[model samples]
Every structure is written in C-alpha cells, then in structure tokens.
Target: MKSDSTVLPDVFRICFEHYNTAKNLPTGKIKNPNEILREFDFEIKKNPADAAELFKDMQLYLKLTPNTLTPNFQNQLFSGLNQYALAGDWLTSVTNTTMATFEVSPMGTLVEKKLIEHMNRLVGWENGDGTMATGGSNANMISLLVARNKMFPEIKKEGQLNKRLIIFVSEDAHYSFEKAANILGIGLDQVKKIKTNPNGEMEPSHLEEMARVSLSEGEYPFFVAATAGTTVLGSFDPIDRIHEISKKFNLWLHVDGAWGGSVLLSSRHRHHLKGIENVDSMTWDTHKMIGTGLMSSFFLTKHNGILRSSHNHGGEDYIFHESEIAEWDSGPSSLQCGRRSDALKVWLTWRSLGDLGIEIQIDNLFTMAIKAKEMILEYKELELMYEPSSLNICFRYRSVSDVNTLNKKIRHRLLEEGNFFINIATRKKETFFRLIIVHPDLNETHLYKLFSDIIRLGNKIKEETEFCMVKT
Candidate 1:
C-alpha cells in the first residue's frame, strides 16, 4: 500500500507462486469448494497483517486451477494465456484507472477508440464504430440493443411495448442471445429458433420461411442473429445468404462470432465469413481465439457513432467535464461504469502478435481439427457427430449394442478419476463428449490417449453403473 514500485515485486511473487502451484498440483480429486472458499476468505481478510499465512511454500487454496495452459487442458475455448495479455492486465490493475471518460482516462479512451477502428478495418468498414464489452455475452446483448434501437428508434426514449418485437436465430446459436433478448425486456418467447442443417449451420431458406410465417402471424420481425461459430457445435451460419434474407425483409443483421470471429485474421478461412462485411453489426471475442487472457469481447458496427446514439445515457454533469481539451468519455456510450482498462490487454496482444501471429494461431487450430478428425475416424470405437467447423469436435464412443450407457459411464468416470478433463453435451436427447482443440500444444498423441482412456473406462465401468450413480 506504500510506494507502487515497492509493492510490485510482492504482486509478481504472489502471482508466480500461485501459477506454479496450479501448474504443479495433482489432477485428481477436486478439493472441496466450500472449505477452500472459507480458507481463501480468511486469507483475504488477514491480507496486510498475515499475507504469509495464506500461502506457505505455495500449497494452499481449494479451487481447481484448471491447467488450461497445459496441452491436456482442452475443456475451454481459450487455452494458453499470452504473457503480454497478463502484463497488460497487471498494469491496468496497478494503475487502478477507470475508462469512463477521456479526461479521466485519456490514454485508455484513445487506445480503445483506435483499437475499435483497427478492428473495423478488418471487417472492411473504414468508418465503423464499436465499444469493448465485458464479455462475449454482453457484446451479443449490445448487438441486440443496437438492432432494436435501429428498428424501433422510439424504444430508446420510449420503452418497448409488448408488440412481440421478435428476433430470429438458429437452433445452434449461442444461448447468450436469448439472455440479451430477456435483458432488453423482450420476452424469451419472442426469440424464434429456426431449424439448422445436420452440420449445425442455419438453413437460410428455413430462416426466410420462418420470417414469412412471423409476418403472416402479424408479429414484428426486427432482428436476425447469425452464428459465425457456435459454442458446442462450432458451426457457422452462411453470412452471405443470411444477409440476403435480412435485406429482403429489412431486418437488422447481427453476427455472433464470439467463438469464431478471430478467423478473420486467417486469409484462408476468411472466406467462411464471406458476407461479414455486409452485416450491420458483429460481436467478436479476442479472448476466445486470440488467447488474450479473459474477457476481450467487442461489439462492433458499420454505422459510425451508432453505439453512442443507442447507449449514451443522459446528462453527464460530473464525469464528462468540459474544457479546452474536452473529449467524449467511453462511459456515456456504454452500459458499464468504472470499466477496467480491458483495452490494454487487447492492445498488448494486438501490438505483440500483430495480424499475422493471430492468423497462424487460427490456421493452426483448424489444422489441428483436421488431424483430430482423422484420429477419431481411425478409432473404430468412436463416432463423430459432424465435421468440425472450427475447433470443437462432437463425438461419442461406439461400443457394442448397449454403448451409450457405457460412453456416459466412461465420461463420468474420467471426471472422477481426473487424469484429464473434457466436456460432454447433449443434442436431440443424445449425450456425447465434446472435445475442444483450442490449445496449440494439444497434438494427435494426447487426443489418441484421451479417446483410448474413455474406451478403457467405458469397459471398466459398464459393470458398476448402478453402484456409482448413487456413490457420490
């Protein structure tokens, strides 16, 4: 709490200590959450007086560190944490600055504005506008807010009537879009789900027919959210065809590329987002694909200064002080106040990697997916749900006659046994393992063993399903 420079060493020491502990800890038997939290709180409360008690030789705490940095850690979209991203985050916290106003945070505001413009250029919009959001979901919500404002300009000043102003999305789209509709005071029922193809891509014709049916039923169709990369399935709805439908009906186009947007950097995969430049707005999360630590989400638009029009709250008498060097603050144009300098992390990442590094990372992830598919096909016991569109692979083991129960038993056992951790998802009432291939270090050998372990566990647990179900 004294000189900032003097305190920095302790911060670095403590951070690295925790990092090493997490990296070295045992993978089995996740420590009890409640006990760990109680101990952690006790440590926090004794902070200045007893920092040593909280950590002794780096063996403390009750939470699983989730070794996402390790190649075996494939449960999440973001795997390895970039050193530049962490450096930016630590500096931002030490400065303890808020990004509300240019005057209060001149450098931060400028950095964010410039970053927005830089991102806009890639989307082929020279004059597009945007705001860095808290997370991908919040960014998706902002997209809905902007679209609603554009379609019903009055809603900005005069709230939404229960006119059933509907929005359309594919069945495979991220669930955050629904949360956005609910937050905007649009009932959850107002979100219409269009059917998708076997590959999980949204059917454009189905969307068109659904729009016609909505119109026939006298419901207002105002927005359509297309997914560039779905969370579980890793599917992309055709942007070009979806744009055609949006134009035919004058609907606002919002692309949720939270998980897949970073592919924009890849010259080869860029064609997958062909008509992305035509969309009204987009939600992109650098944290997911760029490995920029956590929460690097941006809500971007083609229309200049449209974000300010949609979200700028009224009467800034205190923060937006006028002066000879007056500048507009980011707060007035966002739903957040006291925003962390999230821009710093993204800026550091962009500055360090530039566009090419990001492209290589993306291309490598897709290439890894290709190798993963080959490995899955080679194993006679496993079945792939669909071809991976990005980095997630949905597949299950195909054992003898009664295999589903065996596969489910193996997955539950893997989590309990805890040599490695993976996720499972249910689609059309069928449950299957969902392997994420985001980390660059995860090669074919790791995946091969992971699949092998599942089958071994499946055979091991087939006899004790009834006993283990009620064991824990």
Candidate 2:
C-alpha cells in the first residue's frame, strides 16, 4: 500500500496469505450477480485512489471469487496450480517482457524452444515445430489454420477457390473446430461432424464414409480433427484407425489433445493416444492435466516450417530488422504479434517435475478416475452415464420422473451449498454430472462425499417437487 521498494514485498505477503487461505477453503461461496454488485465496488474512476484502498479492493476481489485452487473444486478441465508454476508466472509478470522476438526475450525464447522440443519428442516427433498459444481453443485454431494453409497455400492470399473445403471432426470433438472453420472462411456447414460410437469414440468407418460422400459431392476434404479427450466424456478417438482414414483421404490429421495430451507421459495410459506420432499437428494444454498454471497451451506440428509460412505476414518495418538472431524470433510463427511469455511457467513446472514426475501425476489421475467409477457402480442410487475412459467420469443420481431436470437442479443446489463444486453435461438428452478427477489432492473420500451429497440433495429436491405438484 505504501509507495517504495517495499510495496511489492507487501503485495507478495498478501498474495501468499490469499494462496494459503484458498488451499484450505471448502468449495467457494457462490455469489449471484446481484449480490456481487452490491458486495463490491467494481467501478473504475479517473482519479488515482489511495494505495491502501486499492489493496483492500484486491483482497475483497479474491475473497469473492471462486476458489478453483482448492481440492474440492472440479468444475473445469484444469484444477490446482503447481507451486513452481506460480513462482515462474510471478517472475514473468515482474519481468514484463513480450515473446515476439528473441532479442527482447532471450531466456524466454530459449526456454519455450527447449520446452517445445522436449514435448515434440514425447509426441514421437523428432524435429517438429511448435508455439505457445493463449489457450487450448487458440491452439486448436492455430492447428486448423496451419493445416488449411498447408493443404491450400493459395487460399492464404487469393482467398477461397471454387471448391468448398471441408473439415471432419468427431461428434464429440470440441466446438473450437467449428469456430476455426468460421474464422478461416471455411463455412461451418463444411465442418462435418462424424458420428461417434455409443462410448463417445469417433468411428473411423463413419469418417471414411463421410469423406467419400463429400468427395462425390465435389467437395474438398482437407482436414480431420481427432480428439484425444472429449469435453463431456473424456473419450479418446482411436487414433491408429483414424490415421488410416486420414491417409486414405490425404487429409491433414490434427489431434486435439488439449485435455488428455498429458497422458503421453504415462506409459500405462499413453495407449489412449496410440499413433500420435502420425498426427500432422496437435494441441496440448499442460495446465489441464499437468497442473501447470492456467492457459499453458501449445500447438505442435510435424511439418517443419508450415506454421511460419501460414501465419507470417510482412509488417512492422521499424521492428523487423535484418539480424543474425532474427530467424530465432517466434513472432512470425504465431497468431499474435505481442504475445505474453506463457511458456515460462510451464517450463519451470516441467523442470521442477521432470518427465517422470509428470508421468506420475497423470497416472495418479487416471487411477483416481477408475476408483471413482468403481465407487459409483457400488452405489445403487447413482448411475454411471458412460464407461470410464480417462479422468472424466460422468454419472448422476437417478430419479424416476424428470431425471434430466432433477440432475440439473441437483447441480444448482450443489453449487449453492458451496461445500463442493463440480460440473454437469448432457448427452443424448440425458443430463448427468461430469465428475473430473483432476485435482492433485482429490481422493476416494472426496468422491464418496460427492456421491452422498448428490443422493441426499436429489431426494430432497424430488420430494419437494412432488409435494408442489400434489398441492397444485
């Protein structure tokens, strides 16, 4: 709060305090929009406020926000942040450097390059190219852009040709593929959603049939996105079989491994992504499975210079100078001009926990998922929506009437209670809870408690609903 060299240290103290508090907090206290507006002063003023006032505001903000760092939190793809990752992120912020060029970010550049090299080798690529993206969605978009430009180079400048370029993705694939298509001028209609099996894995035969039909209809099939971990079901499409289909059609194979790519480190679970070496490009987010901080996403490609060729454009005459080190600059190969050093946190985290450490973390999550499934099966009131494939275990408390509505209400009540925070998703018109075994500290006790809460709350909601109906 005071002006001087000590201000930063004071802020760090507050941060550490908040971090300690967050780790121990039971699920976050959920605040509605109206309550948040009344509870905090969010308006920005033209005049500079006292440092003490601003510090108080910062504390209040942290207090009101959801505690995603806590072990009880399992609402999203990512969970607790790694300590080394936090340290690196703080260092990166204090340094305040951009990652466009090596000259500006010498250590950052080398760190990113080395991290990419290490990750590429893990994915079975000997000399692949990669770049750190803003998020997993951006990584997927970059993959799509690179694939498109490689397949149709002229489209980069000359725009769309006579043919309607088509892309294929499993029905379970992330929606980012469709968003990428729209951004690239490839119509959303051209993005065909190939049907998946009952287990949510994409069917290669269906993809082949669809590609054949598209070709017969005079459409160009250029790309196929195979998901390594689907959003709702955590299903990994059979990469070996899908690779065969991609080869037959001459389509660029992009594996969207944003959620499950960390499995590559696990010898036991790595079989989920078999034939990953054959993929033209991939998206992997260490923040999700590896517990690096938020938004540590990478877009990797087997093609050497395709990314630079696809995204590069001549600009910034003042900034672009002929120099020996210019070639090492990562600016030309990315979608953003002024990129933050997202690689530093991941690099630090990876260094803190070597490849084996990463493997153990991922392997533990997979084992926890299996344990969760077994616990669900043991409960008669709970229904396992789908077979366990990865860390994502979908299930719900069963009710005789209006099960979908009941599950939705149960989730709402769960959040309102603020003892546990989880997520729910619907498939085939059936709503169910998507319990992710993502947190490093989540265990059988937490799973047992979650199931108990769901059943207890579900019965209460059903009884209230029936009582109201009878009164009406």
Candidate 3:
C-alpha cells in the first residue's frame, strides 16, 4: 500500500463535501440518471487527475447523497450520525483490515466480543454468545438460521428433509424475517404471520393459535420471531407472554430488536422487553438506535457457543489452525468470509456513552416521543394513529373528506417543500404519518415545527381539493 497522495486527498475532500451538501436537499430539481451521471460506468483510470477537477465532480455526487443528519431528514428509522461513531469509522478505514482473521483484525474481533458481552449482560444473559453482522436484517436472518440449526441440527447435513419446517413471526414483524426464512430453504410460505392487535403488538393467543394450526397441519413450527420495536408502529409484542408460549411449544424464540433493542440500556424502560432474557436468540442494531455508523448490528444467543454450531463453515484446514484456547476468529461464526471492523464504531460509541449515557439518550428519545404524542393530540387537526409504545409516534392530520388521500397528498407536499421530511405509512388500510424521534438533536421546537408544518400543508391541500371537487 503505497501512500497514494491523490486518492487520499480526493476521498477526504469528497467526504467533507458530502457532509456539507447532504443538507442542501433539492426543492424541485431532480435530474434523471440519463442526464445526471451520463455514463454507464466510471473508474479511477489514471493518476493525479487534478484535485480541483476531482473536487468539482465529487461535489455533484455529494449533492445527491441523503442528508441523514438533518432534523428534517426523517425518511428512515435511523435519522442521525454519532460523532464518536463516525470518528471510529475513519479509524476503521485507516486500519483497513478484514474482521475474519485474528492476526489482521485482532483488535476489531476483541472489540466485537466485548460489545457482545456487554450487550448480553444488558439482556441479563448469564452465559451467551454473539457476532456482528452486515445489517439488522442479515443479523435477523442469522438468528433464524442458528435457531433452526440448534432446534434441528440434523437438518444442517440432511437439509430440510421434506419435513415442511416452518418459522413464526408477527404480521407486524419486519420483512427481513420472511427473507431469512426464504434463504434458509424453508420457503416463503413456511414463514407464518401471527396476527397483531390495533396497536401493532403481536397477540400471544394468535401465536399459540398459529403454532397449533401448523402442528396439526403436519408442519414443524420450530421458531417464533418477536419484534421488540416494529419499524412502522414501534410496537413491542408481549415478549413475556410470547416466551411462555415458546417454552410450552418447544419453539426457538428469536426477538428482532434491531429497531427497539436499545431499551435494554434504559433501566427505566427496559421492562418494555420483559422476558427477553429468556429468548433463545435476538438481533440488536446499535446503528439504528444508538446512531452508530452503518452495519453495527449483533445477533446474540443465550445458548453458549451455538453460533459456531450454526454458522461455522468453509475450511477445515489452514485457517482454523491449532490454538491453546481457540483463536477467536470471527469468520467461523459469520455468514461472510470477510467482515468489516464495524464493531469498533459500535464499541467506541458504547464505551464513550457508557450504559448511563445510553440510558439518558434512550430516555430522552422516549420523552421526545411522548412530547410528540401530546403535541399531536393537542392539535384537533392532527390524529393520533396509535399510542406510541416506544420512540415512533404514528399519526396524520384530520381533514373533512378523502382522509387517506388528503394525508398522502400533504405528505407529498411536505416532502416536495423540502423544509422537512416525515414518512407516511399505511396501516389497516388507512394512511398516516410516522414521526421518528431517534435523532439526538430533535427537540420540542422540532416537534412543534413538524406538527405546525403538517397542519399548514393539510389545510392548503384540503382547500385546493375541496375547491377542485366543487368545480368538478
């Protein structure tokens, strides 16, 4: 690795410009790809391509990047970046080592193990094991894979064996659960969806009913993926009740806490995930809740060393060399041969904040959600969709007619206006907005502006549509 001056400087300036332009979102000008990139492919063909010229081209790319940092950038679950985590990311890139090998990513592997140990303790697991994954979905998938393997080890070698193996998840569970089921060769149909209540929490009775049906229908119901925090509604399925059913049915209980798992740090609110300690496995995404850099997700299991039994693959020689007490290489426990040092970012973020810092942050976010709910309820024009179980407040503005269509148009107008961005969701065949309070910078003013802007837009849209309807 020759210290390439041009490439290094180019990448740095590019990143700087990216951080700058990400917030300057376009109001109406969005050129099509045909006119924007203009070419099908691009590469670093030559050396010293003039820093000034390179910087200009990079700025254009930066302008297109999503401004995940802004208070108005509420398009997804994770809305901001942690400064500490971002610094760790820079160090990670500088080290540039694959996480699979101990000799290369020794520190990275140890950091992840430490993080897992800390997280397991947070979950109240006395003896547990875990591994960092590419994303929450991948982590969730691995959870299913490991649970399946642990429940039916013979299937690993014998392969499904036409037993019609099935897994269960709430209808409100993330789509990743189904995707994981598909990848494990269980087929999409084998992923049964349990019904949920109006608030979006999975009904425990529904889970038991589904399990009975599956068993009677001659299908093996071996797993139940519960959601600690569903993406759209932020609902928590009754984990304690679900755990009881799982224990009674001999099911491998896995909780998808990628979105809401951070509550483990909030001692005041950790009870929201009651009995999570009893679950067989769980997926937690620090990146989503803690604002760690991307891909900081972990799949943890209470069964000691089950990941090795589940995901251990590839070479039986050379790499898995002899060591006194096991070398602790991450490759054997992962789905990928070469994982990144994603753990360091998460580790640094957690270490910097400590459990107390995280608790405060989590508490703050929850308070913000409560504030948002109160503000929404105060507005006669605003309708509280479902009582927020966690940090996501699902609601939309109330209007005279075409409530769903009006809400959708107001959302579209709000996005096009570019002052703010709140995501719209459809639940039970009704349209509404889901305001996420995950970003640390969001405060009362932010919530007030969001509600005020929404009402303003709703009124404008209602007037326009009503006049149009009258004319028609």
Please, what is the whole-model Cα lDDT of each candidate in the order they appear?
0.82, 0.90, 0.83
Write down the TM-score of every candidate: 0.91, 0.98, 0.93
Better of 2 and 3 by TM-score: 2
Q: What is the C-alpha RMSD of each candidate to the true structure, in Å?
A: 3.3, 1.4, 2.7
Clashing residue pairs, backbone N/CA/C < 3 A, model 2: none
Pairs that clash in candidate 3: none
The predicted structure with the larger TM-score, 1 or 2, is: 2
Give one digit per residue, the lDDT tens place, for model 1 in 286-339: 888788888889999999888888887754577666666444678867888789
lDDT of 2 by residue, 1-472 (tens): 2366755677899888877777767777688999999989888888877877877887888778888888789999988889899999998988988888888888899999999999999999999999999888999999878888888888889988787999999989999988888987898999999999998999999999999999999999999999999999999999999999999999999999999999999999899999999989999999999989887999999888888899989755966567999888889888887888888999999999999998898888888999999999999999999997898999998888889999999999989989889999989999999988898878888888889999999989988988999999
Q: Tell me the spans in candidate 2 whose CA falls farther than 4 Å from its real position.
A: 1-6
For model 3, give the 10-residue run with minimal summed lDDT. 22-31
* Runs of candidate 3 exceeding 4 Å displacement: 1-50
lDDT leader = 2
In candidate 3, what are the lDDT values of residues 1-472, reduced to their tens digit? 3445777777786676655554444322234567556732346665756665565666666555446777666667887777779888999988999877787788998888888988898898978999888889998899888888888899988898878988889898999988887778989998888999988999999899989988899988899999999999999989999999999999999999999999998888989899998898899988877899787888998998888878787765866666752558778888887777988888888889888998898899888888989988899999998988898888988876779998888877776676677788888898899888888878887778778989998888878877998999
Cα error of candidate 3 at position 233, Å:
1.0
Tell me the TM-score of model 1. Answer: 0.91
Worst 10 residues of 1 by lDDT: 54-63
Q: Tell me how candidate 2 scores on lDDT.
A: 0.90
